[model samples]
Target: MSVPALNRAPDAVTTRVTAPGSRRRPDIEGLRAVAALLIAVYHIWFGTVSGGVDVFLLLTGFLITGSLVRAMERDGRVDLAAFWTKLVKRLFPAGAVVLGAVLLMAYAYFPRSQWTTVIDDVWAAALYYGNWHLALGSVDYMAENSAASPVQHFWSLAVQGQFYLLWPLLVCGAALLAVRLGRSARRGAAVAVGTVFAVSFGYSLWITATAPVWAYFDTGARLWELALGGLLALFVHRVDLPGWARTVAGWAGLAALVLCGLVIGDSLPYPGYASLWPTLAALLIILAGAGTAANGRLSANRLLGARPLTWLGGHAYTLFLWHWPVLVLHLELTGLERPTPGGGLLVLGVSFAAALATSWMVDGGVSRATRRLRTPAWSLAAGVLFVVPVLVAGSLWAQSIERDRQLRTELSSNPLAYPGAAVHLDQDLARNLPSLPVYPDTTTVARDTIDQTRACNALIDQTEVVTCEFGDPRSDYTIALVGSSHVRHWFQALETLADQHGWRLVTMTKNACQFSSGEQRYRGEVFTECAQWNDGVMAALDELEPDTVFTLASLTSVRSGPEEHVPEGFVERWRQLDARGIDVVAVRDTPRFSFRVPDCTDRNHRSECSEPASHSMAERAPYLELDDVPANTRFLDMTGYLCQDDVCHGVIGNQLVYYDTNHFSYSFSQSLAAVMEPYLLEAAGRAPEAELTLAEAALSPEEAAEAAREHDGSS
Candidate 1:
């Protein structure tokens, strides 16, 4: 399973070691160093989670809560403005530096298609809402093919920033309520914090069970981890363990802290019960050092306080900020998904250097320069200097991407200039691709790939069948295409044919769902939503009673391995259509690849990305092997046209075929319209019309423009 991209811990709100009344806890600071290192190591070597993020959350809760409680006792109220001033000044300078650097690196190293995501993430990270942004994207099926954002690791910082904003307010409320009830403010706050811990923890368990991907980045689901640390803070001063007991407990907790990531990796559900291993381990270490004076021989206090670890701890904020981006930059620069051990070391070394330099600029230069003018207002102003330039650059870069999309939109108008798949179909149109520019260039191919059925299709959650009609909608001759996204993406081809044949085109599709009732699973859970959608599609077909029902009779599974077969449910559906005297076009399912075609084509010549015919599908269509075929169901296999001579080219006739790993590009579908015309017409129980000349058969310039305009989304 692909783990969610939330694999790192974050910095605390501030790097101030000693609060007004509290002494520095170098051990906890060094734990921050441990957390930061665990994240980097686990990510680069294990390719999984390390629970380091939970440790960071626990540390933030303990330190920040302790600071706030002390202030409440001393000042007689929670100092909101003072806390905010210190946080914005101390935290954002280094954060802004990282975001700016990521933006520049993304522009240089990342693909243009990824620029939009980087632009959004840069602003979101700058404004402290990146966690929510990532939470939403985690469940977006369309974003499944995307590469990790350079600044994606900033989500943990965003979560901490949000907590810092709300923690003070919650404690203040608890303090006010305590005064009204004649109770100690500290005890009252502890009670409130415990309540938050319980509720958030319960919600975390439920969300992780049902939607683990979204749960991983959810601030609400993670709030309890921080609150647990808050509870530890309120009670730590009272833990009066014997010195020997403290030493033993401290070492045990340290061992457990390192073990949590390795033993309970991301293969298990996280920020839930599994997260307790790391959170409680961090709390135990902090508790062991509660009355810190001298370090024990093997205690966490001594181990974490090694001079180098302490230094990394002091600068953990910038180290956390720089490590993931540095690692991702290495991957983007080289086309490798994961680095070699030596490469990982290089990434870490670069991360350490960048972190130290960034820390010096933020801590030494900025703090020193502002020392004389070190008012709350001055800190806020200085932080803004780091943030505004990045936002401005993001806005300008976003505008440039839009212009690139607009220019590419014109490529569809001149067919001769970029004939796409037509070059493969017609002898006169055949041309070498090397000289002609690929329309919908690699820079914007992702945009060109549209949800062709969004106007008619159901979302993953939507059970009600939705339909959209196109191409001579009022015509008596009609065709209804029903199935999964494969059928949806084929709409351009069907639409082109319907326009020529003067037939109404109806599409019924749901993402990740085929017209089957065999009880499939989506994201490792029973796909009840898809099952319900199939039933609804059946009902809709009965009501419309179109001349023919078009669907994929065979299917391919990229996960199950490279082979094609007919699902029993597909045969049942075809038989039902046949029983109703509805003619059917059971188009053979297409091959799905393991890599995103656009990304591969961007870095390599398009032809170099081709897969072998054996990997594309089974030797022939599986439905043809059936003992008894449904009478009215005519199967259409275009594998011959798609793959020839034991090789499936990624680019054919100067046109890229698949948009993502599985789906066809809209232009490629249009190019296939004429090729599939005879079988589709036969499926609709209509005789073929006289063939037109290649020039006459092609979509007119006006029709091409119309097809482009009719495509979904702003692009």
Candidate 2:
């Protein structure tokens, strides 16, 4: 599920009870405060910043593992039954409170369709399986521009819960092995800590280098951070250092911690070397806090030891529990990416206030109530009371699955009815297209490449890649349009007019086709799919010797100001194509939608679906020239076909021209054939309208085969 290292160390040990009046570790509490604040800021402002969570993981692994190991030494043996019960008691109450509230908020804020996904997540969360679900789905948690699941944040919580389950067992086993070997308790603990740290860190570094995405979210890759913490605890008593050195270390550590949250933005691979800054800082603070009173002056400073911060620090566990759910629910209710600055402060204030109330009320009440639950009946009741509401809320959310599917079907049939909704564009064309137009058989010339005219049927099924041939193969004219969904959208119209003229349209486009010259960011890492696909397309184009290559204007053009640079790779690739004697036609992008495609049809009146939005053609003006290239490359502004007046309507001329957000419908494409016929003739330098006989117009593929069969029968 969570990468194994990121998961709980799957070991169990009894909870440890520290002696009364143990020397106060003010710095550790301060560290906790810092970790909590980093998480809050990152969640509120730069939710993209995940290093904060890494720091938290290090601290959690260190603290809990340390406690469990210490308890194992004192108790002589680790009690698995007591260990699990205590873990449940500590973890489940706070988790249940947060998840229960999140489920309620999801129901209140989300539409029926949105709630189904949320419900599915809630059920996963209840069972501590969120990491498995999210990883399998390849969900991008940092995508603020997209819709979110209410329980999305719970993936981290699930990881921690899994860690708790395993760390204790590992500790117990290590302690037992050491006792058997006649080793001192401290020596045994040290060996256990060192062994785990070495193995886990080695694994983490490799995972961080090789599979950074999995390393980021998976528990296995991250266990080293926790192992580091556990190891630190074993040596806490043995480390002998000067007071000045400890003070210096404490201050330096705090400074390093602050810099990590501030300096580490979204650019770096997280939970890797980037995480070392905060983790090492956390280690320093923990070490500094444990030294004698001489070194404790700064480590146990009056400011850090102050009532309010330490009080929040005391309730940090509870605060972490309540804060995220509250903020998530608040955001859901408002539909804001995150709370505004003022709103963030309000969320912080309200969350802490709620945390305090829950800490005093539910957390304290549950702890007290469960103390009497030593008997099976009372224990069962306590467990059921805690778990049933979460289960039921989760189950209710689950039932919306069928409801969501049915709604999606109805919405796809009529997009105008659902506002702020998105329907699968490929499915729409497959379900709706009535029939294909018939044309006279073109002569089969020895063509090495596909023709554009015959690419119509090929474009319909988008999931699979297909090859087609269009014009007389021997002709010198061949044009290839290569791109992502953006290029595919224009194919229907291009194919229609291609058949009318003799130009072959060689189709080679893929979803998310980034014609990159070098490394590029995609799906949270440097990806090469687009680059590899581009290489293939370029090779095919060179071999075919296409007369012209059509490419989309930069996606950056859609959002950037007129002066903004087009994506460098796109421009460079086109230039490369131009150098090969291919005329480059840079087609400006079509109007993109502000809302989901189905928002136009969503029955809910809360969404904006009435009119499509438009931007200036000036946005595309910069890269249109391509005159610097060797071959003659032209800029075509076909925005006019999709736009009207000042605005681009999703529907054009009373026709649902766009089946979804920006993609033109095939029906719309068929109509545009008339308007584009002139351009096609001009581009190919040929004009030959196909003259279809009545028999040819009416003849089906089956009938043609039948006619051949009849002639054969007569013969």
Measured by TM-score, the strongest candidate is 1
Best by lDDT: 1
lDDT of 1: 0.76
Measured against the true structure, the TM-scores of the candidates, in listed sequence, are: 0.90, 0.68
Alpha-carbon error at 299 in model 1, in Å?
A: 1.8
What local lDDT score does residue 677 receive in model 1, on the 0 to 100 scale? 72
112-137: candidate 2 lDDT, tens digit per residue: 43454566677777778887776544
lDDT score of residue 79 within candidate 2:
55
Count clashes in each candidate, considering only residues at least 3 apart in sequence or on different chains: 0, 41
